[model samples]
Target: MPHSLPPAAPLRGRFDRFLILGAVCLAGFVLPLNFTGPPIATPAIAAELGGSPAALTWMTNAFMLAFGSCLMAAGALADGVGRKRVFGIGIAAFGVASSLLAFVPDLFWLNVLRVVQGVAAAAALSGGNAALAQEFHGAARLRAFSLLGTTFGIGLAFGPSLAGWLTQTHGWRSIFLSSVVVATAATVFGLPRMRESRDPAAAGIDVPGSLAFTAMLAAFTAGVLEAPARGWGHPLVLAALIGSGLLLALFVRIEQRSRRPMLDLALFRYPRFIGAQLLPIGTGFCYLVLIVLLPARLIGVEGYGALQAGLLMIALSLPMLVVPFVGAVASHRVPPGVLCSGGLLLAAAGLVWLGRADPGAGWIAPLLLIGIGAAVPWGLMDGLAISVVPKERAGMAAGIFGASRVSGEGVTIALASAALATFLGAGLQAALPGHAGRVAEIAQHLGIGDLAQARALLAPTLDPATLIGVYERAFGHLVDALAAATTVTAVLVLSLFGGASAHDIANTHEAPAARADGRPERVADCGAHG
Candidate 1:
């Protein structure tokens, strides 16, 4: 059945508007809080659960995979049914999952509950953004989206420190328990007042397209994530990669034919839209990956306690809180392409700076620069992408945009893990120049999170200077690789923006001639952005 539009009520007051943003934005807070929190809590979780470093990695992945997978479909459902209904369900579901996670009997159960949490987060994000797009128009839309971005940053900024403190003092389970309380309260208060809005004309979700895309992302991530431990050439890894390729091809075909595709392949026809999509991937790789990796590096390599490392990361996260508002305000004056491309290049510069930064000087400066740079695109791109679509499909567009983000995060981590593993293996070889057989054993031991072993593992044969150089070079290689990837991504995004029209730059949904069908015609002279 088609969605029935809610009767337009009187113009809400300032308090009501604030509450609307809070209702949605508060839900937005759930994801980053849980996702980044785990890196800080990993040691405690693993110690209690008796798992390895790889197992700890899955604690993040299990949630990410499910979140990315359900996002597109959830968006479609929200568009067809109603944003408030889906948003309420998402909050209740996440609250339930978080409560379950608080008492999870083992690591396996914790991971399982994370998937449920991801699904709930997906619905909440899509429904919240869709509601904002529906309720606010023109300049108010920009401000509303900015607030949404700001709320998202707040979640990211606090996740590490809070998780660290809670895990250190109250225990790892406190992190989840806290969320249970917050989410339950938010659902009780926020959901009731969240006015229902959705795309009345939207066809039901394209099941085949959604499943194929999910399969493609899942297989690809599985291949990349596991390749570090299993080897790229391992039968399982190769099979996964091959399956990902096949699934990707099938997804394209399905979308091309489906009347109501979850992801309209034609949206890529707009260079700005493509840039909008790719921009997030770079941001995710540069920003969120930093959120996870820096904590691990500080706590593991530098020998800082979890709490100390988390506190230090505040330098990196604080700028994220302010930059979104700056970018949102700047978007009115500057082109989306310019803001996005500039943000991407700035972030890449920060990555390169961090890649080469002297350990003695500390990461605070480079981390600060990275936060400022990432905030521009992170703050602006969602509004930019959704601007390319029609208002009715805002929920669906939001879903696709978010799916790209979470997918990028998962893929980047997987790639980073692979590169890190490769770098570590090479470091072992470099430290013990003549000992080929010992390298594999030493690498395996290091994978379990013992940083003291760099010198100790190779002590009898290698000197202190050699041991230190090995680690320095290994970390440098990982950082440099990420920097290179970001630079390349930025250049491509810039090129896309260079060729886009004014319409693409303004707001994707407002672009003229768009229809309910998934197909988009070749856009020539689609008006200029100004």
Candidate 2:
């Protein structure tokens, strides 16, 4: 039986809903800030901590892998244990971990703390929608979701800038300290007032399934992250990749057989659900590629500081903020598939335009185009994803969506890193052909015999302008690759849009009696309805 919402209680007021939204949004801020802060401060952190190139990569990738892998388990746990309680605990733990990071003495300890932070972040990110879905209904629900999207957009936009400023002024420690304060405040305010929202009929925790899924994700991520350091054929990396495949196979089998599976395999049977999930995967792949490439191009290639790089990236966020309103309006009149497809196309065009940008080109035009293009897809994807699912299963639906986005991002970054290494290596090898022996010696000294190693060796021999030129050429290759990848992804998403549109049209024409989950008949169901 479906879990029904409680009758409209006079005690549940607008203020309560606002509190829930505010708390969730505040908690959401910490994770993005933690994720972005290190990237902006990479140079500084690496300098102080005596880290190699690989260590720096771990600082960011560890959080991503942990956050992505644990999301499904966190979602099921939220539904079983209680949304408010899980969210509060997660927020508090994140605060504690972030605070500890402020005093981390070495890169290893920092990575350890980041993994803990990631776990806490998974808890908060997973439960956020379920909490909102439990609190508001109808237009209020729509408004709350819109606000949540806006909060996420703002966080992504501002996180790097905040990190840049703090890293420049007070050092990287301040970034973690700031996260501690923000997370702590959210946990404090949210604990007493946040109401519990759990479906009593949901099955018990799927411990075996969760373990299998986690192992699969961990192994897969480790393989991706290690590919650059160890050749693709390295035994440990190969073994991890093979083990991940086997675990994933086992996970699917378990889900099929378990009475209380963490994932409901049946959701994929709905074309609308499948389309909704794919939208994020496509968007996430493009988004991370752009996010990582833009900063490296601006700061590393163009010799910009952390602040300048962050400011340049703000172009990506500006459009993300404004386009959702367009999506919201479009959602009311246009079919979601039409809006989503259009948004993705626009974003693809923007990335293409960005790829064509010259090293010294005026920044405003490209920035404007990217802002507009990126915004459209960001505004509409989440709401559209949830629209297809039954309201009672919103938590699971959201969990799946979040997992797709996170996993896509992780894979995208890994691929982009590999591509970047290849391009950078080619450029370095070409630029210093006759001096290969000397370059190799320098690379050994620098402990970076990769493409970046070659570039560093050539840096000392070339003039400042020529060094800049070499980096620009290398970075351009990455931009082109990202654009091509994004375009392919956009085209695929457009195809999904067609399928989703057909589903929406069928749903629209169907009689209310035919609708599953009794959504059309119930008012309370509308509030917490995904």
* Top-scoring candidate (TM-score): 1
Q: Cα lDDT of all candidates, in order?
A: 0.75, 0.66
Whole-structure CA lDDT of model 2: 0.66
Q: For all the candidates, what are their Cα RMSDs to the real structure?
A: 3.2, 4.8
Q: Give the lDDT of residue 351 in candidate 2.
A: 59
Off by over 4 Å in 2: 1-11, 434-459, 462-470, 499-530
Estimate, for each residue in 190-292, the C-alpha lDDT of model 2 and write its tens digit.
6567677775546656788878977887788778666645657999989989999999999999988876566767656545555566565555544555665
What clash count goes with each model? 11, 4
The residue-by-residue lDDT of candidate 1 on 1-530, one tens digit each, is 23334566665667777787787787777667998888787766766886655666788888988888888998999988998888888888988899889898888888888989998999888887887787787657767776776677778777998888888789989998888877876777667666787665667777888788888988998788677656789999999999999999998898778777778776676666677788868877678777877776676666677788778888778987788878877766776667777887887788888878876356789988888888887787766666667666788778988898777778887777667767777887765677666665455435434555544655655554554466567778877878778788888777777744333455433433234443333332213233
Local error of candidate 1 at 297, Å?
1.5
Worst 10 residues of 2 by lDDT: 521-530
Best model per lDDT: 1
